[model samples]
Target: MRAIGTIWMVARREVKARFLTKANLVSLGLLLLAVVAGVVVMDYFQNRDTDEPTFTIALAEQTAELRPGLEAAAAGQDTTLDISTMGAAEAEEAVTEDLDAYISGDPAQPEVLVADEVDGQLLGLVTGVAQAHAMGSEVAALGGDPGAVSEAVAQAAPDVRSLAEEDPSGGMFGPAYFVAILSTSVLLFALISTGALIAMGVVEEKTSRVVEILLATIRPASLLAGKILGIGIVGLIQVVLLGGAAIGTMAATDLLADFEIDLTTAMLMIVLWFFLGFAIFALLFGGFAALVSRQEDIGSVTTPLTFLLFVPYYVAMFMVPNNPDTTLTAVLSQIPIFSPFMMPMRSAFDAVSTGELVLSVVLALATIPLLVWVASTVYQRGVLHTGGRMKLSEAFARR
Candidate 1:
């Protein structure tokens, strides 16, 4: 009961130290604003109507007969055009500013004028219209009806069919991909950033001998546990707020309608992964930071762990999306070290089975006790030794 009380006290201190700070408050505010702003911007663009006419062109009187053909070609290709009739000089002037192109010269063989490079779709529309007009003229000369010939040519096209299986997760740019990226990115940021804070806090306390005063009454393991729990609570708050803001903005803007994510399941997975990942990282970081006395040496001791964190993160970001159901991803997602990063992303893609999730969680949970023992041992020995950097073997050695 006393140990538990001591840990709770330590945890409360950490939370007060971090949560009550002006900088943390400002940072939280800015992060929430940025997240909501980003989602709003994406929603605005995603819902914007793009069906309106985007290309404008002016036709001279001579090429005015080509207007109907051009309009027909544009409409057939599902392109919207804002076309106008004007004199050749006026068309040429408008092409430099208000118009995308100016059409003049012969009806069948017209010249297209533009101030800059021609748009591919616009150019294609012009070519198709000119070819059909020239063909119509030839058909008239040949005594066949031009309109009927054009209609016959338009109707002649091969029906195309694809044999590839449709991906339910919507390929690379679908809702699954969006969730995978979002969840993984948030995990990466939370774990790495918060993990560093745990390490730096350890180093700071050790440097200032604050841990000595605190340790007089509390166990080393208890202090470590308390610190991790407190900072973790704060970190979890940041994650939930930022993630919830993004999701809420999406839902409010109707962007969530386009995404097929099971919001409840995804949020649960993310929160679970965050706790698991943070526990593993915080312990390792705290233990390693005890090896060094100064804040400057914290990075050197924790660099390897930081690198370890990125391996699964990069794999999750790059490999998992492309090969969600692959053997490699499956194997990594089951491992304790990699699962924290890999499983959340895989779950987001709906590639993980319930059995797989349960097994992964069990494996990760099983590793925590072993890690706690190791980290507690290292921290217990090294937290008091404050000279040069202590070796891992030295910390593990019994007095």
Candidate 2:
């Protein structure tokens, strides 16, 4: 009960303090503006250019007879092929100018001439049309029915198959990757920024000798817990607000309607990881801050931990493309220290297994109490020591 009261007090103080600050307001405003701008940019690009393929073909002598077949083939492939008769010189010039858009040759056995190498889709389309025309000509030469040969060729084309049992939630990797990267970036930046603020708050109070006065009334653990809890709640709030903005924007724009976000699962994971991550890092930062009486010493003590944070970030990056199934990824995903970032990222791609995710969450929860105990011990030992700076080894030993 005492612990609960202390946590509530700290949370209230931190929330009020932060909300009243001009810097915090400015940061929030900028964050909102950036989110809006990002949504607009994404929408603009998504709706911008059309995807329909347009082909301009320059046919050589005798190819005009194949125009009907070529047009039919182009229509089948959802492409617009503009067939024009040209002399060799004119065809060569057009091919040299835009190889991708121009295919040169007789309507029958038309050879594609391009300024450069053609794309596979265009090449395939052109090849299929040429094959159909060739088959028709061969039948005519053999004194067989060309119409029957054409019908047989059309019936022989293979059916396109969809690989997945269910349609993919998102259209493709583009939007999935976008959401994953954007959400991770926002969450990571928010956590690190707010965690640093919590550290600063602790240091400020201690440096001003305000902690000494407060300690006379509150238990050290309560004070520490309160500060961490309060700031953590605020951090969670920001995360929720930002996530809501992103999801709402996506929903409104129909950006990821095909791809289900599993909002409940995502929110649960975000909330869980935010608290666990905040507790672990914020507590460590608070303890580290206490080791230094002056602000200058704060950075030196925290530098090592700061560098450690980047390891999980980079590990998550490498794992994104690896589909979260690699040996290294599996191990890292289960590790509490890396789970928050790693699991969420892998989850975004539907790469994580249910067992792996549950196991990771369990491990992270199990480790939190141990980390909190260690951090609190360090805080208790170093908070009152107005020394130059405390070594990590010494801080632990004294605690």
Using Cα atoms with residue i matched to residue i, what is each candidate's TM-score against the true structure? Answer: 0.86, 0.75
lDDT of 2 by residue, 163-239 (tens): 86763545335555666666566667767777677778878887999999989988888888888777777788788
Which residue ranges in model 2 land beyond 4 Å of their true spot?
Answer: 47-50, 53-74, 80-149, 158-175, 260-264, 397-399
- Worst 10-residue lDDT window for candidate 2 reads 167-176
Clashing pairs in 1: none
Model 1: runs farther than 4 Å from truth? 32-53, 137-148, 168-170, 173-178, 248-265
- Backbone clash count for every predicted candidate, in the order shown: 0, 6
lDDT of 1 by residue, 1-399 (tens): 998998889899989987889999998899889988988887777667434446898888888899888888878777888988888757666887789998888877788899989988898888888899999999999999998999899999999888997666667877777877888788888888788888888999999999999899888999999989989998898889878887788778777685567866777788999999988888998887898999888878778998999899998888888898898889989888889889988887878998999999999999999999999999999999978999999999956
Number of colliding residue pairs in model 2: 6
> Given candidate 1, what's the lDDT at residue 265?
77
